[model samples]
Target: MIVPSSLFASGTESWRGDGRTDEFDSVATASRALADGGVTAVTGAFGFDPSGTAALIAPERFARGTRSGASRPLPAVVSSALTPSDVHTDRIRRVLAAIDEGVVDKAVLARTLEMTFDGPLDPADVFARFLPGPDAATTTAFAVPLDPAPGRADHWLIGASPELLIAKTGRTVTCHPFAGTTPRGVDAESDRRAVAALRASDKDLREHAFVVEQIVDVLAPLCRELDVPDRPQIESTPAVWHLATPIRGVLTDESITALDLAALTSPTPAVCGTPRAAAARLIDEVEGSRDFYAGAVGWCDAAGDGRWMVSIRCLELDAAGTGVTTWAGGGIVAGSDPAAEVAETEAKFRTVLGALGVDPADLTDRSRPAPAPTST
Candidate 1:
């Protein structure tokens, strides 16, 4: 057997990355292959917009230092840290109030609220909430700066991402599009319809388009040669049908890193919205605080072939390890319903509910979904 450590021979070797953006349809197979191939980890690089580093990370103590994407004899890494921004509670409240007042009909609002644990935070405890069985499908990963440094957070997270971002040798760069989100439906047919509707919906297409364009746009400046699909293809998973696109290019300068490219593609339209700047501004003003929820938090090699998940499916652990603080959001198009948006938020938070070690019945609380309008 090729020992895992022996599989990679690129130690300090020059890299020419070849990347392809796959979708959920390819995730399982691809991940399996990576595992079978003795890849330390197979990651979904764009996870930062939702779960922060919780997907591609394996539970283990990694050797320290930033390994380049093309490094050899190391665990497969996912991303570099994208820290949370200052909380904007006032902005979130304004939008919700606007929605409630009917000044605006629909808007996709998000929050990055922070919660502190008096003691050390253990993500394993946080993960306990979501994975029903010990063997439940879940992954949590982070890069803690070595030593007791009092600077940036030593730890990060990306709870559970369904997407993957990739880059490889040969100067190729790519992203795997994964969307068409739906909850675990009451029945197979219900889930099927959710997937089907998302696939057919124009709004969903618009959302996918936003991400594709941004990926292309983001990678454009960094690449010497580029190739983007004219249209996205349908890719299905157990729970969703993502709009997948293939983006490939050669790096303009090797000095620049894949992490840099991943950084640019983060908060893509899958989690954010079209007209990204406008959407983020609106969200910043409307969604309150995002904390680390939507930030890109993953580890990558020195060459940048790691995965980063959006920190969506996660919860913040309390020091006592008894409870967790969590948040969720939805894509609010002009046609969205207040009640439906509320329901979607509720659905979006399911994974967190599980991570907090709370039963679905346990989350019933007085916090109702507040409205957000376009009046800002």
Candidate 2:
């Protein structure tokens, strides 16, 4: 986890195993149960759907220090879209129509890409590629083993996320939510123009407002004093520029844990939308199960201090390690252009796609025929 002052990396030496919450119902209940059972720290992932299952564990021992693996050269891999480009854009158009009818103010639409390698892929190696230099502090890189579903094998959820869902230490809490997006420009002048355009975009600003408003609504009652900036600043990753607001507050109740805050604030307009339930229903009708793709991942300790990050720019590695599925998404508002939304998701995918040695331009090339859908 990346905190304001230090970076923490941990490896499990022994697993309590019993701490797994097969079906995550309530973060408060599950966390209380773990703490009652003497688990010092509970770590794992929460599925995207609030009612879906979660993979959490209590580690008996944690080995910490510098990250210990060298990134291996990724082998040639086959790539295919789980959700085709045309289908995704069509979904966006449908959402635009819904917005017109006032069914929902905004919704987030997502798509996935599957990459199968020639040989076994190492989760550590792939994760290594996500880490920046030692001094880099903004991105949080994670690799958590997921508890397999009834018929599925063990897998790992790995990513380098730029958004923090929530964090807590003592009575202090903070969140940095990102919404508006634009791809980074190739040249210095173009990059500056891109950032300026995003700042002035009415559509993008509207989309970002929904996210910040929702977050404040959720946090206000729980906070003794909240600080929300009037404007969003630009946050940059290697491939995209995001409109981000850094929110900080002092909790009214020290009893509120990080996981509790995460559960309450997540699925914010950043990933789901305003009137969250309506948007979620629309997503369900169109996108189907998100699994843990846009879920929250991180850890909570017995002291109720911890951090959780939104699971974007992430991938799930299959048990055999030969295949990985990664996802990207964009928030859809009334004025959204279908084609531009498609391009937005492509730009979001560049984080993991570039790390995998795939040129992101391949995703945007219209001359190339779309790959056939593949079974995960």
Candidate 3:
């Protein structure tokens, strides 16, 4: 077992898989092989966009299963943190225009902040120091390496995601998607008001329901029974509050694995949008490349059971660690505002920004250049 001790907190070694595939069936081939071997555990990541690829890995070295001393804090100085000013807003404006044109109902647009560190970064530390309080208990934190495929460098994807793409155990599956978002305020009263507003906001509710409905539509065909809540509950992280709904169902086909369920429901309305094909086209035309920003990441076992979380609030780091790119964004509907959407992206970047010792609030300045009309 080749365990790398200095980098990760767990000291585990995984064989990273490689390449992107055009179809979900290609991604499932690995998991099906593991299941045929009896009970086993495999883990890794895939991309956010449909045509993108995946890297599902099997662990060659395992953790010691022991706790260490108190975790260390992240670095305080940021060499540089930057985002494209008018570009982000312009992207959102175009998507909104599409919504008005009846091309799509909603689309989750994303923004990335690229940072150059003074030295190599330890992804494990990034995951550990982010949102380190009681409220973060529900979050799924990860730091894993991608396979060494052609044109793909040895990079690690790290972050804490609060949305569960899919989880399977026995013949049961669960999907919890979060859509509507409100930034948490510094004061308790302010925070409470924010939560209340999220629940009451018609736009937020509609955005949240689209995600729930998409998951139901995908799973209903494969499951014997399913349960979806009428309303979303407020799921809180240290930095933001979200409208989250947990959908549960029992798979009629025992042969169906967790990976299969994830493939079906991924790029859900929460991350992608409604009338998927239209939203995908808009994303391609407006947002450029998403890479793995909103993709699914986690593990599957030999028994066909596994867990995958929506890859949000994350960063991609080079193996050398000299650079990092953090990602965050939100759903854009008819009522979405350009400035408000910009602020929402900043809110989503809080966990990573905070860990990097940068004040996330600094990015919310509305004075940033306004987006020009699409004709420009």
Please tell me which predicted candidate would have the highest lDDT against the true structure. 2
lDDT of 1 by residue, 109-178 (tens): 5532233323344443332222222222222332211111112233333244445544455366666754
Model 1 bad stretches (over 4 Å): 1-107, 111-122, 125-158, 165-170, 225-227, 230-242, 368-376
What is the clash count of model 2? 0
2 or 3, greater by lDDT? 2
For every model shown, the clashing-pair count is 69, 0, 2
Ranking by lDDT: 2, 3, 1
Candidate 3 C-alpha lDDT tens digits along 1-376: 3543112222222222222221122355565666567324556677765345776555543232322322655443345444565788888888988999999999988876776666666755665554334445357666666643234466777877788899899988988889999999889999999999999999999999889888888989998999888889988887899999988899899787777677777789998998987887777677666767888887675667877888887788876776778778889999998898888887888888776667655443334432332310
Clashing pairs in 2: none
lDDT of each: 0.45, 0.77, 0.72
Q: Model 2: runs farther than 4 Å from truth?
A: 1-29, 134-136, 148-152, 360-376
- Maximum-TM-score candidate: 2
Per-candidate TM equals: 0.60, 0.88, 0.86
* Candidate 2 residue lDDT tens string, 1-376: 3211112342321111222333323455467765575666667778776456676655544334366555568776755545677888878988989999999999999887877777787766777677654433456777777753333346888878888899999999999999999999999999999999999999999999999999999999999999999999998888899999999999999987888788888788999987998998888776777878888888777788888889889899888888888988999998898898888888888899877777655543233433333322
Task: Flag the better candidate by lDDT, 1 or 3.
Answer: 3
